[model samples]
Target: MKKAFVAFILLIFISTSRAAKVTDWLDSYNVLWTSQSKGSYDSMPCGGGDIGLNVWVENNELLFYISRSGSLDENNCLLKSGRIRVKLTPNPFINSGFSQQLNLRKGFVDVNAGNTNIRLWVNVFSPVIHVDINSKEKLSAEVYYENWRYKDRPVRKGEGNANSYKWAIPKGLVTKADVIENSTDKVIFYHKNDAQTVFDVTVAQQGMDSVKSKMYNPIGNLTSGGMLFGDNLKFAGTSSGEYAGTDYKSWCMKSVKPSSSHHVLIALHTQQTESLNQWKQGLADIVKGIKSNDDKKRTQAWWNSFWNKSAIRINEKNKDSEAWKIGRNYQLFRYMLGCNAYGSYPTKFNGGLFTFDPARVDSTLNFTPDFRKWGGGTMTAQNQRLVYFPMLKSGDFDMMTSQFDFYLRILKNAELRSKVYWNHEGGCFTEQIENFGLPNPSEYGWKRPANFDKGLEYNAWLEYQWDTVLEFCNMILETKEYNNEKIDKYVPLIESVLTFFDEHYRMLATQRGRKVLDGDGHLVLYPGSACETYKMAYNSTSTISALTVVLEKMIEYSAADSTKSARWKQMLSTIPPITIREENGKKMIAPAKLWERINNIESPQLYPVFPWRVYGVGKKDLDVAVNTYFSDSDALKFRSHIGWKQDNIFAACLGLTKEAQRLTSLKMKDSELRFPTFWGPGYDWTPDHNWGGSGMIGLQEMLMQTNGEQILLFPAWPAEWNVHFKMHAPKNTTVEAELKDGKVTSLQVYPAERMKDVVIMIKK
Candidate 1:
């Protein structure tokens, strides 16, 4: 008892020595709004689980856009659940002395105006949103459901860029009018997909009609419904409006609670149901589960643990400085990712679950709220990885399952296509594909003149780019290193992904008069790509690096079975070596062998520096990696701290401390939105998650890095900056460090024995 008690005391001492409360810093940066803004762009975002709300005060009325993840309609378009507007008997927001804030610690928004104050929160464990209003005196309130899609709206070819498949989809794919209804005192609305959905159209176009029955379809008979209920509220019929070229309708409810406080609950549910009655029942059940006080406690408990997981803070002493903004924005961006923690689909890279009106983002687009840059039907793997890769270092492992399972669910369909197309046995995932592992219907270029490669993409940027899944396979392996829970389930996935490269490349080699076993027995990767750049190349660095790293991990995990282990070991040796070339008398990593054209700005050669980590600070090939970053012409031209940016990552990997700090600060700086995390339209859309993801990864690597069993503290951190951070590393270890004024004031490592592996980079 004495020994155990002493150990516990020592643990607390070690933790407190280095780490302060994460919430202490978070509290200081909470978003506060004192005045009303012009449009939805000025709104503050709040959400929990899979539901997100854009809350703002405009035209003396409180309004919010309700969006739930994976709410697809008949067109395979992700749609907004709807909008809600609230009005007080006497509007306080119109007067001087009104304030709104997003409380980061509690994961909710608070608005105070005149005599009334409203607290809005989405339940973290249940699909329900709450609006609790309290006033100094008794007040009457009117809540209304505002829906712009009250009638079928034709999806045009050129709407806001977020409509990923709109142009490719057939014209006249109209969004059916939302079916609005009132049951007793409740006002509800839902959008149900038609019997023939975009999924059916895509399969028929792709010549997969024979096997369409076996494909996993998420659109048929799909419905998304929302219900609003409160004891004080009574249904007050409906109203219509035509404003700003938009025709819309609203269901009104008037309420006057006896007391000063009014509580209203809104429950949202999306399902593949047989009928509207089933959806109504599902919503009723959700409300019943969350209407009690106990559920609020459960939701708060989940959020409390979420905020406690891991955090990073940069202290610049000047709150308004760019450095402070970087740190605050990092946390803010992470908050958006957390909003979809329990989503059925992985958060979309274009906007995740928080996209607002399209007209607000781009005035010329003038599309509905559902419009975003990329379509809902397609998940572009290249941009998609940027959204989830940073979760590894942030220790948000639980949140990663949604993405991993996304690919797993589509694995069989991908494999079937490979077998049907090339008589091959491995799954073939393309750069842009539907959720079911088929290439996007419109992007597949089925109308090409003649003799085109049926398996290759007509778009130069996406052709021969099937290896991005390797990054996710590495993510799974890394997750196991941090926690041993999911290994058994992911092992097969890792094996199959690696096997595809081996089997498919061998088949391609035979047609080029190159034997699979010829000249070093390496697999010939002709017609390959170094990212979207270096098209029509052979033996690309990115593909080889992914093959080498993923196979090594697969062999290690599958060692118990000799056959599986040997197959992976052989495949690793058969992957072509990463190319090196001399440019301006400096040796650098080459994009690929026999490179021809450059289509995009991505630096595929430096990929070895990242995702694979074959060359980095402590690794033997550090000089080569550093030279690649400095001398690569294309890399230098494309480098920016914007959406899907990689310069910060390369700098950190090369131990270029000052460069890492400068680039990371730029990448993490305020995204120029009223809400700082809504980053970009840079190569994607507003609130570009890939941009946020790249920044998150860069900041994480600057603070903590792992090479095998050795942990490097502040490996790429600059000397002038003071930082406090706690981040997870491989092998069930966490390193917490505090550096103030160039001194290593405090440091702590979990599982003290791992301290032997610690390499402190900070100078005394």
Candidate 2:
């Protein structure tokens, strides 16, 4: 018994040592800068709990732009709250000795210069922003709340891209001014939407006016903004200025008395109500709920627990190597996603909440900081799916709620679309849809022919693109498979989306021919599209794969109920086999059985290898998928590491080590901007989230891939690129392993029985 006790104590010491090594590895990736920023382009991201701020020190002033989730305006544009500028009488930031760092583990930004030190952090549990400053000598401080929308401003020719109107702006459309009030100790501001918003116009444009009252309108009577208050500060006066070609007004405040320490707080509130007094009360309540002494400790604790969940570290001893950069950037992007974990809505794919001034992204636009290319409330399912899929492997199951709930809240609006237009029984979600679940008015076409179908968007790139929503349905079911999460709330949503394809396609078949199914008793998938690329197609492989996989999972999930399982089994049978053709005398998956025109640069032929998981390392027909990757003409021409592209993902899934390494390296390469992960305006906007998301997915796939009961490790990972990773899998399992010198150095599997199922693919 004495010997056994000694052995147990030794094991505990060894485990604790190993855990410390992992945490130290993460600390090395923290971003540090020795010089001040030139502009917002060089800013560092800092935020939590659905709030995002771009922090920078320029021209002896510390500045940050505040942005919050669910702050949609009358035009359905997601607006920035305001900007805050901080200056000190003795201006320590003007000195040559300066440093700014993003502390990833504690989730805050730290800046130091001369004798002053500043720390900025947002509460992870509440909507509050905190700034703390300490100096050896007592110093006065000036705080400025800047607003660019102080007057009704006309959204110029191309500026409409920032809102729902796009290029089809209605006559006399302008961004309304925000109301600001200044008192001795605080300045309160907010933007309240007009009674009529884009939601109303979209409903009438889509011919759903009769059922408008029953629809859900997220922008109607909405108000969003916050108050600026501090411990020893009082309002000074007002001033006006211009920044980056835009005009603005400022409400100024000054320190009541110089002190060695200063603390400032900005409490933000957003609500949808017709009473302005009610909105003011909500803002006051946020300020009243502050527990300053406890909030910082709690926020830091949340970040610590978050980093402990999962991590991927590569070539830790060599920070200069490309392998190390990819791993570091992966964690940095994940930090950005974590900032919006509990958002009322899912993070936007175009830029999320980290976008900066438009002039910084494109010098020609010269628009406000609120300017992003794609409309604010527009949710493109194809791009949005890539943003959320990587969360599954990282064991961030709780973050998935924002996305799943976004669809649940809009389910009834989608169903109403089907009933009002086609008198159908399932939801009809378009490719480019609004927050209210209607087709974007511009994409729905202001010049539609009288006889055209009201159920379809007039844009060619978006027509017949209803299959993208199926990916979300699959993500919902995957959460249950990966984490054993309770998904009872989303079952109705999944059933409705699946039912749409089944009944709507059958109805189309009946209208054209006598039988509802093809001669093979399969659903006649005509008038379809393969990801806006293979247009006017028949039996699109993407649609077929989506229907087959979702139905099989749904049938398995509903096995306890005989009636639902039987119905889904019948629907599963009607999904046609994935199309294949002979290319250079080798079998390769086809985009569709037939197609008329190539509309865009996307290779949907590899759909079976990825999200659907029809072909992979542990699955059959591996060579056939490999042939398509190397030999398919369209795939070769379209392969790239640009925004929203998934070729790297395909290579990883097929276990093509050299190809996967080459493509993912380009995808993860540092951005041209000062911040390495502020990726691109490629095919979207700066800090393209889908670009980072695709990179995240590829790196995860290279490390591990799961096929039902089997988990394959290092399937596509390079043998010599030493790595330490912790990743989640199906059946509530986690695998933590270390690889060095082309061999597995250590392996730990939770729920020991799962150890038997893990197959080490790399050579020992």
Which candidate tops lDDT? 2
Tens-digit lDDT track for model 1 on 670-726?
Answer: 778788989887888888999999888888888778888888777788767777787
Which candidate gets the maximum TM-score versus the true structure?
2
Error of 2 at 500 (Å): 0.5
lDDT of each: 0.80, 0.89
The TM-scores of all predictions, comma-separated, are: 0.96, 0.97
Question: Per-residue CA lDDT of candidate 2, range 9-89, in tens?
Answer: 222211211233345567899999998889888999999989988999988899999989999999988999999999998
After TM-score superposition, the amount by which residue 601's alpha carbon in candidate 2 deviates from its true location, in angstroms, is 0.8
For model 1 the TM-score comes to 0.96
Residue 392 accuracy (lDDT) in model 2: 96
Off by over 4 Å in 2: 1-22
